[model samples]
Target: MKSKITVMLVDDHAVVRAGHRMLLSQYENISVVAETARGEEAYQRYIEIHPGIVVMDINLPGMGGLASIRRIHGRDPYARILAFSVHDEPLYVTRALEAGAKGYVTKSSAPEILVEAIIRLAQGDTFVDPEIAQRMVVQTVTGTDPSSLLATLSAREFDIFRLLVNGRTTREIAEELCLGYKTVANYATQIKSKLNVRTTAEMTCLAYQYGVLNG
Candidate 1:
């Protein structure tokens, strides 16, 4: 008999997790072994469970998914993570891959794609959503890097950048990210300098231009 592939699901929404759990349960060779709502808890749970694969969301509250992927990969270089996100922008896909995710799948993908991604990751293969793959190819061919400024920001800086562009106040971001006010201020300054935007409005504009913002 083939051993079932164990998976850890990390998402903020309870209903979403439940739905995925049910969906994955339909497969005889796959099982969800653990679940978490916060990105900060993902690495810890991974350490405790050591599941075969981790399915993570990118826009998690607190440490955020990218940071969690980095931490897990730092601890276990061989760890396999599949980044599942609603953000289909190539920037998000690129960042997730750079963070050590073995695969990237958009939430809008067909349900079967999620199963295919999980199975592929379990077998030590990479999977990317077809839509994202096409976009990445176009970007590569055009030589137009939509994530130029985003690529320059370090992981921490990128975390702060997302919050800032989403209209979070410095204090609010500091509190949510558990950074000192001065630390967040310093990161904000660095992010602005790297992006070459003097104001938050400009930053928001850049995010919109790059398709970071949904609307």
Candidate 2:
């Protein structure tokens, strides 16, 4: 008999989870055994559920998904996690890979790619969305990038940066991304340091100068 691959879904939006659940329902080998809307919840549940694969979104309610990934990896180094997000930049892609994620699939990709990613990761193979990979690799391998310095950000830090550039306050970023206020603040600091900015206003100015807002 074929063993079923236990999958967990972690994302803040309820509708996205519902849609993902429905999409996975059509696959025979993949079973979404658990789901959570926050990174902290997913981490706690991951210890209990021991799913074969965890599909995680970078932006979550309590802890950012990357932090949850680190926690889960600390407990079980061999844990198979697939970073699932809308972020298509090198910062996110490189960070997910650095954190031991076996796969990276963008939300904009076809639903079929999600299942394909799960299957590939469950088999202990690495997979990255083709379109995202292209976008991510170019900037890193290129020289003298004056853009948003996105190549320097990790997955979680990039998540915080996105919210900040999109007109979200630190408090609002904390609430939207499901992180503690202090944690969000720290991420903001790290982002500024990476981009060499001293203030949020400077960060925003650089964000525009780098064309990330247009991105």
Candidate 3:
């Protein structure tokens, strides 16, 4: 018999983790090998277990999922990650993919969709929730979506940008990201310059306009 595919679950909620475990357990071909509640721990666990697939949440306790995905994919180029996030916004999807996730699925998706995404990613295929995929395609064709401009930001820059728009101060962002104050401040300035925004208000306005932050 073929060996089952191993999966690692990374989310901050124990309840969510338990629900996922129950859902995935019904499949004979997939097994939950490990779980972690923080992004930093996710990378550590990934290195140790080397699970066949990683189901990661975007809003993690430490470093955040985008950072974790970047770290894991940076170390192991073949790492297969499925981003399971509450964020249905196109910006989050774009940044998650940019950060090296093999697939993106919203939390609101049916359980079957998540299972199908995991199987597809395990098979080296990319998957995106159909609604998000269609919206992205429409945006691309209409040339009206702000995602093209947002895509210019690197993974780290994008993370900083999101925090900045959410009213996270430089010091707070630095602390949350575990970066030096000066470095985060500099990134803030650079991000503003890249986005051609003069102030945090402008940044917030742009974020709201693009659905980066729900109004």
Candidate 4:
């Protein structure tokens, strides 16, 4: 008998998690082994349960989904994570991939697409929503995508950049990420230097122009 593929669901919404569990349960070969509403707890759960695949939402309550993916991948290089986010921008997909998620799917994707993504990741294949993949291709070919502008930032820097552009104060970012205020401030300065913006207002403008600000 084939062993069922185990999955961990990480999202901040109880109803969304329930919906995902119900949808994934229809597949006899798949089972949800664990679920959580916070990225910090999700990593701890992954360490404890070690599910076959992780379906994570990028906009998590604590630690953020990108950080969680990075932490898990750092612990287990073979870890397979499918980044499920509401943002359809190619930049979000790129950031998730850079953070070590094996696949990216938007919330707008069909239920079957999510199922297919989970199965494919479990089978050692990567998957991205077809629409997102096509958009990425188009952006790459056109050379107009702002993703290239921000690609130089590391995963941590990218996370900080996102927070800074969204009007988050240094202390707020530190509290959210559980980092020291000084460390977060340093990251903020570095992010501004990398993006070539001197002021938070300019950073916000750049983010808005590049479509990096979450809608």
TM-score of each: 0.95, 0.80, 0.93, 0.94
Tens digits of lDDT, candidate 4, 166-189? 778899989998899999999888
- Quick one: ranking by lDDT, best first? 4, 1, 3, 2
Runs in model 1 lying further than 4 Å from the true structure = none
Q: Give the per-residue lDDT digits (tens) of candidate 1, residues 103-132.
A: 999889999999999999889899999888
Name the runs in model 4 displaced over 4 angstroms.
Answer: none
Candidates arranged by TM-score, highest first: 1, 4, 3, 2
For model 4, how big is the CA root-mean-square deviation?
Answer: 1.5
Q: Judge candidate 3 against the unseen true structure and give its global Cα lDDT, from 0 to 1.
A: 0.89
lDDT of each: 0.89, 0.81, 0.89, 0.90
At residue 159, candidate 2 shows an lDDT of: 65
Of the two candidates 3 and 4, the one with more favorable lDDT, higher being better, is 4
TM-score winner between 1 and 4, please give it.
1
Clash tally for model 3: 0
TM-score-better candidate, 1 vs 3 = 1
Best by TM-score: 1
